[model samples]
Target: MRFPPPNPLTLGALALSMAFPLHAQSDPSTAATLAPVVVHARGADEAPKDLPYSVDVVDGITLQERRLLNVEQVLRATPGVNVNSSGGANVSTIYIRGVGALYPMSMDDSSVALNVDGSPLSTRQIAIGTLDTDQIEILKGPQGTLFGGMGEAGAINLTTRRPTREWEGYARAEVGQDRQFLTEAAVGGPLTDKLAGRFAIRSAGSDHWIENDRTGGPLSKPRDLAFRGSLLWDLTSRTSALVSAERHRLRHYGEQLVLMPYSKPASVDMDPGLFQDSRKTIERYTLQLDHRFDGSRLTATSAYTDTYNIAPVVYDGKLQSALGRGSREFWNVDEAKERVFTQDLRLSSLPQSDVFWAAGVSYSTSRRSYDTPRNTYGDASAKFRDFDTDRYGVYGEMTYPLTRRLKLTTGLRQSWDRKTYNARYHGGGMVQTDSRKLDDSFTTGRIGLSYALTQQATLYATYARGYNPGGFNDYAAQPDDSKPYKAAKTDSFEVGFKTDSADGQYGLNGAVYLNRVRNNHLLSYDSATYVVSALNADTESRGAELQAVWRPGDGLAFTAGVSFIDAQIKTAVHGIGDGDVQAGNRVPDVSRWNGTLGVTYRKPLPAFLGLSAPVLHARVDYQYVGKRAADPQNHFDLDSYHKLDARLGIANGRAEYYVWGSNLLDEQYDLYGYFAPPSVAYGAPARGRTLGVGVSYTF
Candidate 1:
């Protein structure tokens, strides 16, 4: 189905900006002619533009222009962002500003907080693995009052397109090198004048790009599918509700690069035909009711999520008999299930000249289970494990105008959490029922002040407290002796300035922040016994970020940003000491310097050129990632690299075609972390240069 052309409201506005005020010079005899320019438009709840904070918004066009498949690739150009991968198509570890989940081995667990469509989605292996999104917003710094719990450092909010009143649909298909083929589509329209709905689906599968020279065979085949739908009902002029649901599944026969940078790295490559098998599925359902009265708003949100993961992990060296006397194949098979339910209610008072406020209450409960059914070749057998956690929180924030130029904002959150863990097995083949419970409550607060220094500039400073709740270990532990972990906390202080000139052609924002973390969590493996576990250690991180955008002329735009980090362990508590990680030691995978630039030009050709000819459009972009460490030991470092990606295409409004290239330089770099027999560095080598073409049509 095709819909009418978009309304001219937005186009007319842009046209006016272009034609009438092309320049500031006219009637050169006495005076200059300058047209009226619109200044910054702040949101109802938006803080002062000059608040001492750094926030980045990546919109829909930018996401598609870059052709990034997932957040992992999209965030590569984001300053202070870091990633660690195990292998191709495997688990990816994410960190922002030197803070992220300790370590994630499977689909049900992750440390970073993920918020989707206004609902909080906890960090999970699968959550980050698959996302067909609309726009991504990354807020840097401590966001304790609003997001709570996992928002220790900040929050990653992903906004998906909602239903529209006009009937519209688009579909795209892509094929490229490495046998990569994918299809994605979305359809939406008004079911009735007062209601609208949308449906979307995406599926993709790819053959392993890397070849196992020893076996002369491909290592894996990757497959994925996702379906989603949402509906909006306008009950009244001031009241409406939305419901959304999504299901995703992934199956693959893949490889894990267990050895890296070894003198004989090739010797560790297992036969390509002997790859591991992994599968995961996730389903999410959410409902929200929003009501507005007298410019004040109320919202209630509820969500349920279920995730299942299974993997038959292969170990080539572990299978090889120490004496070279056996030819048996060995592997570890593991499976886990997780279910989560959450509900929250929020009441926000629109910002007024005198006062603005927001208050909310939230409740969440989760149950997780891990099981290993069997083991082969003298490997330890798996046992059943289960954990349950419940959380309740109440939070409120108030902003008051102390003077015409000065404003103060204060917020507080009180939370309580209870966790129960049941471990069924430990070392020495001993089975024991070990159960433990923990109950703790704490309050977090934030204070911020902003001053409008001038019409185009503002200054702000803030101090906040952030916290992350601790829980029972995910993997092996003797049940009887286990104890619930304590909540980790951090104090953050920051100051900054932001400005947008009257011409509206230039904008600059920058901030500096210092953070001190108490009981920092670290995930590491035991050399003697290969179990990965989380440990609490003391640490601190400080950083600065600066961003500027300049659109000197129509069809010409430029953006540049820089980030510097100085993170370290403040005290020696765990076996790893302060000396082990010295001050000024760059955080792993976090580049001290990151930058990006892009140029785009689009215009219509002369009518003389064929009348049927499509419009000509072109774009080019550049990104740079500086050198950084890859391991906690801070031993080996990943070399800094620069990559260029370019795309040229033509579109008639309804149908479009484009050709693109990624990693144009074919730069080789590590993307993830892993443990090898002799190598401590853990990271997956990224892909080389590849070419592809895409076509899409809207009806």
Candidate 2:
């Protein structure tokens, strides 16, 4: 398939924002195992069977049924992916194939690139809910040829629900333990003969959920709100144009942490005098144009985003200092504003023959300014920094049939990056200013071969190179440490197979991969000064993954996925506090093994008791994460834990009512923890158990 198949129907009116608008309804596949899995990761719609690499996809119905509202929840069931969130979305870090560093996180480049629709976004900017989404895809391996620098491990793409021809809409309300509540609604439909429009809104919040020892009460509350709108115009029978806009605001309080040895679940002991709130706001806009030719399509996408964040905290976990009680608090006030713009143009062949090709060029620019107030030291100390970056790339990829049973794919890309950095510091017993500029270039490519073993099964192997953009340290104490750091790189190799049953009752797939890393990025925190500096080293990671889906009988489905990884620092003569870790240490915050098992069943009930026919729905999911090192030194380890989630519901054609539970066993485990100042340890206790009730109505 090409891109979205054009329809005769289009939007009829120019709807307002996310208010009540004329609605359009979209439907999901009723059968799980037989549903077609098509993706647009390559600038066109195609099945996973045609691609040589591994890409996992989850549709909207699956997300809604499981209540996977955020990236953290979505990754639990995805093989070879992990997340470490420390209190808020801005601090969340994601690791793929055990490559990304999980060191409390910063607004830096991620090993896995994050994208919305066809545009790029920073990993730091997307901690919000994934509401009104059509599907989410994770393309594993080094996606160097098409996605540009930054995706050293892989890439994530989130596709939102688009407007349909017919009038339809949906509304849902959910309430859970601890006063957790969420509401969502979306409407889409034709506004005119040639135009279609869509609008969506999502809101979620929770009262205090974590126990506090000092106040003898619960702490930490969270609030989030988001809105999105889209307009589509069928300029002609062969061309279409789309415009989209979004805005999000989030506010949160409390760290939800427990005093060290990782002993409790959702409990903390602290006496901080006052608590400050962390807030983030984002605005985004995009325009896309597509034109279809006889056997090819041309596309152009442009996007822009503006983001602001403010986070303040108490560093000492005490109220002993006079500065802690007054205007001059003993803490830090961090604030920043960032702006980004990107453009991409491509022409892809909608081949009638057995040959396919795509060529594209992309350009992006970013600028950010940040400040830290003097409260951190309770003195006349502060830091201000500015960063600017530009990136450009050109890429081409082609797949050609070599013989009846074999196909060859080749891709190449050339990328250039330029960065300017500036920093100034006052007080803290030091005053300094630093300014620098750096430019770098890379050549990345992939080559693969695929063989058809049978009509429903295929085997393939590929090799690729990936690049991660270099960055500067804004949280530095000395001028020397403020200079930009060198970029990290990776070489990856993978072999995989995909199979589907002839009757479409089952599908199975597996892949094995190995990666060689150069100058991998890591963070070293200074104990005495509480400063963070960049650390670089070589490393190796190898893993195997298996996934399967089976439909044994009508109205019953089973899904399973498992992964095993051995990721270690190679030349690990890197400094941590006062000591250097040797080679062969496991990567921090990455699991050695993980797996997911899930079952879903739906049956139609015979009409009885003065009732029409209704559908009964039930689903259960189990997740496991293996042991992981807490830090590079391997001084402490986090134990493995298991989680079970269940849902039971009744539904008609347009209405559904459900009850759900997560972590039903109340398992105890640590989400993430670290030693502050290299001595006092604090950990964010994982959530214990929560239950909720929900109702949804769709047209």
Candidate 3:
């Protein structure tokens, strides 16, 4: 199932067509037009077309309409993003542009950064639930300058709904397949003429897909809970303050399925006699204040977040047996906490030309701790542990306009980290105990230039540098004299074009980027002791992507998008060679060709139907992932495959129902690896087709 490469122009056009309204309605006052979207990251109320970064904004209405349950599901249609879910739906991870943290070992090294309000959380596990969000902004590229210490590949900023001057609130309920139940409640109103408050709570849970082979019993679905509350106060005519807090919990029990050599795949249900369970918990709080001065403006933000996760995962999926079939049982307990504070002050009175600038400082500190306990089914003890790491950083960014149509932006940041490890071994007469510490620092900078080709078109070129501080690994086979991980760096160069119509009916954005990476860290296991070791390698990636939005007419719009990536190992050493991956090698989890087309129509029905206004929507989507190496040998490959999904729904003003189907063609494909012994232990499997009907009501 191989296909030709996709054209950027075609992909961009298609994305815009589906996203934008193409024509006006027949009624004069009911005409459909493009709406303006503003992003505060740039510190201005400008349209998405004016932002130089690759940004995707998913509105609240769209999320509700789609009945999106979690962050992973909401981001499914987004380009350059891949989500891997463990069988039976307990564990999930997101890879953005093939540039997310593969291993969640430390807090200092994250490829994709996430910020809720102003707080930087420890792990993606904290961002699992679906909430009442005002907007979700996905900003692409190296965000080292503005965010600092994190976001080497980019960042996702989630802004939750806020209280308003007017009283408003909504409560929603939903029921779905697998005995799934969902409930959400929200309230917002003015506490006083100068004060406001808002609160929201959501709870969802269901049954898992795994069925016990022996007892023919179903497992419990992971319990999901989320709660948020906020308050705003107007101190003076020109000053305001806000405080918000949120909490989430996810609890589940069970393990994934694995394949064994010379045997069929099997799911090793947990030993009920041992009484073992897994759980992940998260808590976060945020506070911010804004003040407008006569000559200068000052803004301050502060937040704290804590996360705890414990999973007794085994290296091999096979269960431990009396004969020792290379199977082992172990539990990993990871705990992390982060505290951040930020402030920005700017002077905006230009005496000469229409020019102004802003300068700010950011500071953040984090601590992480991990412990591993080994259990041979029933009689195993603790093996290794790492106490924690203390990390902090500072950063700033500024923008200036040389002319009305020409502007420039520059940013810089510096970060430092310290780590400590603790060990306890109980295999043989190996009494190994030691503690190591390392202090490292790195700087990242960005420079960009923009030009307005026309009122509706703009072109920009940018050069950005990204870096992350390395730290200690809990499991390294080589216990004696193992070097601490070192810092890694990447530099990117890019140029792009952006266009938007005067009426906002159509919009297009495209970029081509080349990134050079040094000291890239990779994991390898030692054959003798089966100890995992970290290796440093050099690599480079080059690619291009185009995304667009289109609005053809009232109740009619479409969107399409595409991307092409070519990544390879430039240099290799230590049992890792450069030849295994040649030029034009497609990066794993990234597709070479993908696109989606959709349309929606809403109109007034005839009086005979006894209905007021009825709206109908249908969409067709197709995505193709190219074949690539599924193993280190580079010989074994997973064939490329395509999937098509469609949906039809009817909605009125307050309540809506829809029948949705995914993988309509029932095409069988693998989204990730299919490991078979000696090479890798676990391989991700793609799910089959599913049909479901859902309805939602707001009161």
Candidate 4:
């Protein structure tokens, strides 16, 4: 299907109308007040209104109320963000500001960086399980000076709940359609006068929503379990120590793909040999220490992470017969492991001072290995590869008040990266071996100016530079793939404003940005050899975002967000296989227009059924995602769609019960599309309407 291009004039008008200039508004009615939210995505903690860049924060309470199970769900409601999955629970791609990798192949690294408790996760794997969290912060635009190579596009930071002096705990259970079930619990308290401990656990799973017609069996099912523990100790009057650990296990059964353009919304027809079975395990450990002096503080953090994954399946579908293969089946097995260790140290002046300054140094090393074995009619072949990477960086930032109402900020970082690749192949009674080494060094920087127009309003402008280091391709079957690619870089400029009413009854924030990228890394798949590789191109993106929150009266609140992006390639390139990509094409997986609207009401209810102090809560939310191109050629696509979710409940302070529904309209949409062997195309389908009820208790 084809649609008309979006009109820029109409979009500009809409943005101006929705996000008028910051100005004071008068209202006679008194309303409840809202507190300012603080975020720490930068090196130091500060209120979002004071930052020169766009940032979004979601608290743990909102996550629970929405019953969000993964990071993808959290990002769907955020402005200027998009998520695409390969029809699996453990594989996904996230896009911010039209910058992201689009495929599930293990070789491509994500443009956006994700961190938990200051420890970065490998972008090659799925970032799941959002349990026992304090808050999630999303920083838009480049974070090069503070984060180094990984923050080419942006960054996401997750903070976990810490141990407390007083004992407290909570538990929740829920059951829903498709045999969905979930149970989670958390507890925290003091172990001794100076020692505190916290623990959390979660077990969740769901039956297959898609069924196979060939064998009358389920096409996909997911199960997951996770545990986290932490301990905090006051070493002395001026120093403290903290230790944390986490483990997660996930399993999936059956294939994650469906026959596109032919299969029904929730069904598939495939050969029994194509069934997929996979398992993934991840573990992480971290230790942190902090010392405070009269005017400054010193902090250090050390972290280690390990991940393992395995999958065995038939690569060829029923198309084997159609391609005149004579019932020959292709069996393949994949096993992979990754280990990373990182250390960071920083010193900063107290934020309360008129002049604030912070400096940090970081170092990280990672090792990864993978083995793939294939069996084609008793002809066995295997490929084995290993990768090693080491990175080091030093960064510093300073913010000084030039005047009572104006400030200037500047930061810079220098990074060095080195990578080594070793590969071996054995097949057809022959053996081959290869080795390569590559290294690069680069510098990134940021500059910003902020002005307080009024006591409650701030206006700012910023410029930043970021980059992603080059590396060897995992699937190096050809000479071109063996050579390392050049690093990708971006230059961005932004201007924004934030304002709030004196009574805190209304708030508004918006930004406009322009970004130019050079040597942008992209992933391409070869249908003939089933190999995925990397390529580079040039692109440009410009966009605007607006968000508003209002509390017109007691027990009533409304929130809305809107984004408009125009991203396109500036140069042509030769893709994998025999495909030529032309210039002037929109980047894949980026929507032109996205928005969200939400309403919430809470009120105290009269006592009933011998219950005392009961309160009722109701919420409704709607999201719109515009049509997007699936490939560089703009030949295949995903249509525009909308989703609605609602929740209603009653609760006291310690206990609550609620009923919730998602995709209430039962809309059917495609999450992603890909081309496979035998010239066939397939699409991963999104979920339909789902209804459930849950209960929770606090002690």
Candidate 5:
């Protein structure tokens, strides 16, 4: 299951041999070009290149041809974005503009708003689909005025392919290293007059490939299955409705972080009976309604979702096995359940005049509770917490032309939040029960100005303010120690420019931003008692990003993105600490430098088979992540690493076949590193190289 590491030269040659189409030719008229990207965040279908804001759109063609299946892969090559994970697909959080906490807390509100088809998703939820995707939009800066409470920092919106009046479908299958298998299919068509239906399903899994030295068996077998169905009804020429239902389930050995000085050959020194496994289930249903009038549109969206997850990690295992009776009796466990309901109603004026506006009201309610996370250590060694949040907001935005080439834009949100908490903790011979309530109301907004410099270029500047309400830590057994941490208020200033060639052959987008956060959420590890407490401090982050896409001719496309960021805490915090954090510390998981490069080519192949010449498709992607602080305390640093992914295949309009490789060099890096209960540093290593072959057929 392991491949020997390759040198840089070998890596290059391997990528080129498979990804370079030397004996292929393309019809000059059919070469794909860099077209204007349309995004929906502006309250309407507006081309991002024409707008003043910063939006990165990954289109469906790229997603399909590049073989980017999951959320991580889809965002890996994006500028100014990072997904810090704990080795498990579900155990991760995303950081945008260097403004997200890597640690996972079921009670903490996410800094990034993850939306799928207008439905909000929690931090641990699977926010992307493996099939039937339309596009993904990554919007920078605060989006509170439009995306609601969780949009304090940024937003990621994933839209799924809709039901079509014309019959269409695709089925794909892939087999990969480690005995991995994937198969997905989607079908959409008109079921009846005025009615259309779509259904999609995906099933994927991989055998545990990490050899266990103790037993010579693999460490984890990971897999997942997801299903989605939707119905669209054209009630009238001016009104329509869409209803969708989805369910997903996952299983795997999660968070397999070994001791320091990681070894090679894809092996782990996990002890026998490690009790390492993770499981998750998600069910969601949504309804969307739209009506159009002479000059405006009205829309309504509602969703109900329930998710449950359980994961056991041996981050603190060495201490337990040496002192406790067995390893399974003492590892750390995380189990939680959440249910959410959301509704959004909005009206927007059509782009029929120089003046355009939108107004909307939103309401959402969420309830979450955690089950005792300590394994079978003891009956009384348990922790329990319950959190319920009810939030409502009203927002409005307007854009008007101040001059022939100048425009002004502004928006605001009036928000009210109510949260209730209940907790009970019994561990280390201590027992505590506490209940608290939080009620707050706040206002957030943004204002900006943009001017058209030419027919193909626009310049813009903007300021935005966003906030995250205070929260509590159930593990703080004492009342004062459990006091709510201060709310995180953020102010962001940004300038950006977007331009594309008049011929539509290339485009460039760039932005610079500064973000100041008051009462930034931080964590303090009290090593004296081996406990963690939530605290607050101040932080400042400034960064620049550039993204470019170029298509010269002859079926060649190139994409490159780079970002530089300096995000750190500028001051010391309050409350408990044993060097858990300090002044002038780099924000954990915020890499100082990161970038991605991609190349794709397509051309008609020579007549080899006894059929029409098929098109040869090839793609290569490279990514880099600069070293970063692994934990708040700066306990360790994750070294910089390089990764390469490539795919080569042939397509004959309706069917395709390909071979792909991920991390072809077997590059190794820690996904995350954290301290165990007793101060030992442990890390979860990223997955090793994966090679696979796939096929897809369309009808």
Candidate 6:
């Protein structure tokens, strides 16, 4: 199944050929223009063009067109964003502007805040079903004033489609390589004079593509099911209420971690019995209420989520072979459960006013429990831990017009957090228990000024401060490793501009930023001793991003985005290395340069048979990711790589069909790399070329 690496010259020729339209047709009287997208990540609804920071939006239409199955795919084409996943549906890490946690712990929260329908996500290992998406908003920068401590880097906000009064529905089916099949259906309409309801469901299953050399069969097969339902009711002329419920379940045979020095096509030379089975289930419910006055609006939201995951896995990949044993024996059965509850209340003035203001208060609580049973060389042991966290915050922001074309904005937030942990270990005729508590209170804010250079252009500058709270490491087997780490803080400054052409055919956004971070919480793993710890250090990061979209006549559109970042450690800490050895090292998992280019074209066809007018569409996409360091000392580096995708489709008002190919060039790359037990290098390779066909019908 291995394919030769693509030649640069051949790829260039192919890209050029695909960029041109296949069939030239007369231009329609009405030319489409890029629409202004509104975002709610800033604690208020506002147009992205009016914001002072770097923000990007991906609509549901684009998601359908791209056939994106996960958040990582959606973020790869976005500017100033990077995603690293370890060959699982939910195990993903996101980095923005070189600010991210390279190695995340079970208890340590992420640097970026992830939200679905205004409810914050507590765990990064939970699946994000994209069955009925409305839009995804990416806000890049320090957002501590509104989003709390996890917004040190930025935030990702996902909104799902709501019930509409009009009757509408769609059904889609897809078939792909490696025995993959997917089906999705949605229906919505008015249930009564003042009530509307919607329901959506998605189911998918795929056989493993990677093969195990020892067993001569596929390594892992995965299956998933998800369901969502929503209801909207108008209680009165000025008041309304909405409620949503969702459930998702996933089961997979196992995860395949390829050994270092492996050849292309990703084959594992290990015992099939060493693999594990995994299952995950998640459920969520949310309620929203709104009331309007003459000049202002009141809003309230409440949400609850519960998640459970279990896996039986082998800890050492090469244990049987390295120990000269004939069978696999060392293993661990792990289980994790989490429950979260959140509520938020806010009031804001109408957006049309000269002076805009919003204030909100939020309260959230989360509980997590973990259990693991290990069997190594006939020795048995078990470990259990529980964590509870509570957070409360009050935040407010205001924007005042300084003159006709100038405005000043400021925001402030005060937050308090408390966390408690309990651990129990039972092994070797001994039982031990430990308990600890940690708490912190802090203040964060943002200030900015914006000026309109012209009717179509705006320039802005901002300064913000953000922090990630400290937490105790649950994986620590020793007393010294159980201590809580200090909180990490960042002071950031950014300057940016948003502009549109007078003819409304081109748009551009760009930003330059500098960030200084202190007491930066870092995760370190000792493969030899199987111990994990957290430390503190100082780091500095500087970056710039540019994005542009162009639309000419004749049904043509093009988009290009690029980003450059330089992030390095300014001070060395314990467990990394000597002071000078680690001080100047490049930050792990941060790429120096990344970019994406896209081209799309469409042409209408003459009406035929009873069918209405149809359109032929073609698209090409390209992405480039630069080299990245895998460790603190920068000894191991992942080489730069590029990927290309293309799609050809035909569509009308009610039905559509498309053929799509991802990684058309068959480029080989690593998603991420880490040290396995016994200092073995292990990584997950990116998927190879995949070709699929899909059809959808709407009624």
**Which ranges in model 6 have alpha carbons more than 4 Å from their true place?**
1-33, 123-126, 253-255, 269-276, 312-330, 375-379, 576-581, 607-612, 676-679
Q: Residues 138-199, candidate 4: write the lDDT tens digits.
A: 88988887788888778888888999999987777766776666778889999999999999
lDDT of 2 by residue, 490-535 (tens): 8999999999888778999999999888887777776546677777
lDDT of the structure predicted as candidate 5: 0.76
Per-model lDDT: 0.64, 0.76, 0.58, 0.75, 0.76, 0.76
Tens digit of per-residue lDDT, candidate 1, span 1-699: 111132243233223323332222222111111222211111133533633356677765667667766666666767866666655333566666766544443332333556776666655442343234666767676777776766777767677778889998766666666566666777899999899999988776666645454555445667778889999999999889999999877776443554455321223345444444577787889998989878678988899988787766555542343314254445555667889899989888754435777889999998888766555644355667788878899998877778988879788999898877787763476666777777778777689998888878888899988887777766654552245455678888888888877776677888888888787665555543445555555666778888887766644567677787766655433343211444444456666677777776555443232233344556788878877776555656778888888877665444556777777887766565443334333334666676766666655
Q: How does residue 47 of candidate 6 score in lDDT? A: 72
What TM-score would each prediction reach against the true structure? 0.85, 0.91, 0.84, 0.91, 0.91, 0.91
Q: Roughly what TM-score does model 2 have, to 2 decimal places?
A: 0.91
Query: Model 4, stretches more than 4 Å misplaced?
Result: 1-35, 102-108, 253-255, 270-277, 312-331, 375-379, 478-480, 676-679
Candidate 5 residues 1-699, lDDT tens each?
Answer: 533233243333234333433334334347455545678886677778545568888887778766677767676567677776666545666778888753433345577887888888876663345467889888888898887657778888888889999998877777777777767778999999999999998877776755566677667667778889999999999999999999888877466666555656455555545534577888889999999989899999999999887777553344345333345323557677889999999999875456778899999998888665565465567777888889999999888899988989899999998988888777668878888988888888789998889978889999998887777663454555566766788999999998888887888889999998887776566644557677777778999999998888888988899999999887776465556467888888888899999998888776666435578888999888899888766777888889998999887655667899988878887777766444556566766889987777666
What is candidate 3's lDDT per residue for 570-624, written digit by digit as tens? 5534453222333334444445454554454554433233224445555556666
Best by lDDT: 2
Those runs of model 1 whose alpha carbons end farther than 4 Å from true positions after fitting are 1-52, 87-92, 101-111, 125-132, 253-255, 262-268, 271-277, 317-330, 351-355, 375-380, 426-430, 480-483, 502-504, 573-586, 606-613, 674-682
Lowest summed lDDT across 10 adjacent residues in model 1 is found at 25-34
Q: Which stretch of 10 consecutive residues in model 4 shows the poorest summed lDDT? A: 22-31
| lDDT over C-alpha atoms for residue 585 of model 3 | 42
Candidate 5 residue spans exceeding 4 A from truth: 1-31, 102-107, 126-128, 266-277, 316-329, 351-353, 427-431, 474-481, 527-530, 574-580, 675-679
